[model samples]
Target: MTLFFLNILLAVIWATLWNSFTLLTLAGGFALGFAALWLARGLLAPHYFRAVPAVLALAGFFIVELVKSCILVARDCIAPRPNIHPAIVRMPLDVRSDAEIFLLANLITLTPGTLTLDVAADRSFLLIHAIYATDEAALVAELKAGMEHRVRKVFGT
Candidate 1:
């Protein structure tokens, strides 16, 4: 967390030095700060550096999933006979914290053809409504391996 704050400070300083407080300039500063921190990572706690890549990977993975979902949903909509096999699947939860669960639920809901219906009262699982859940087991496995796994990484859980 300290490293994160330091990075942000560096970015702000860079923005001030450049005499432009625009988003682009700030982002460029952040990138440079990240590079500097990464290079000097041996002096700092290792986890923070690892987290940067993990967050980036999660973002990239989410974007890919979002695009694929959009395409699939669009195709189903355009078809004379849509092939979707909708189902509400109970996905067992590995993420325990409220923040983790909240993020996972929101990400699932943000996808094109999926919605997070409800979380189990015990917080042991999530009820997900999927538009293409012909194979419920596969859907659960995919979510477990993909989004849940990435969320865990981001939180270091």
Candidate 2:
């Protein structure tokens, strides 16, 4: 994912350095950046390009979840009576690396009404704060089904 982003940034830098903002120039820069990465394949990790598809899918998943969460939060704000049932729950994680764990935590925090508090010392669990969670089990299941599952796919774990 960082490679993907660096590629984009390199493209922008390409355009900026050349003082050409045209779409054609941007595309050319992107192609050149891709070629640069391809040439360094032997020097870099083998799985660099393979993770692009999963990263794109993860991005799409995040957008969908963000929209859904925003609507839910908006409804709560618009309603005549408040129906917020806040809770903190420890969510199990299959992710081991610090990067993957941090990404999961950030994604959870970005979603409305959900905040990641801490990761367990063992890194097997994530403690999250949610504004509306009447049924703790259901909330945990929803999170596991939604965010946790997508995150696992993101890291190919």
Candidate 3:
């Protein structure tokens, strides 16, 4: 019963905020579908009140790093010195779960200048393409420090 209500409430909020569903009928349909899934699967409810603060902290950190990446890219473009140090570094991820690995890869791709190229055959490593690579150590450190750690925390690893 609680999960059903929670799903309906979530659907209503989503419909309201996005304004994609103009008619109450459509909103009710969405709520019903979501409620059915919620009831059938019995997914563990995330404690949103506890998750909100951590989410905000992660968002804030990403914003600061985004700014730094933007500035660096701009400087490299303007310097006329060919500052593009292109390199592919394989970051061996400690995170074993699929969700955590996907989160890490998505985080890498979401950042301004980096691209997640591929995962290893065993899924133990991620191939990341970076425009600036001072060294292997720097690349590894940057990935571990910049994205992976935060994702591990955010996804409750």
C-alpha RMSD of each candidate structure in angstroms = 1.8, 3.5, 6.7
What does candidate 3 score in Cα RMSD to the true structure?
6.7
lDDT of 1 at 109: 99
Question: What is candidate 1's local distance difference test score?
Answer: 0.95
Tens-place lDDT digits, model 2, residues 8-124: 888999999999989998988887887898788887665656566567788998999899989999999999987899999988887889988999899999999999999999999
Best lDDT among the predictions, by candidate number: 1
- Residue pairs clashing in model 1 are none
Q: Relative to the true structure, how large is the alpha-carbon lDDT of every model?
A: 0.95, 0.85, 0.74
Q: Better model by lDDT, 1 or 3?
A: 1
Q: Against the hidden reference, what TM-scores do the models get?
A: 0.90, 0.74, 0.66
TM-score of 3: 0.66
Sort order, TM-score high to low: 1, 2, 3
- Clash pairs, candidate 2, are none
- Report the number of clashing residue pairs per model: 0, 0, 0
TM-score, cand. 2 = 0.74
Candidate 3 structure quality by residue, lDDT tens digits, 30-128: 556565654555455654333445666778888888888889888887896957888888899878788878877887788777889998878889999
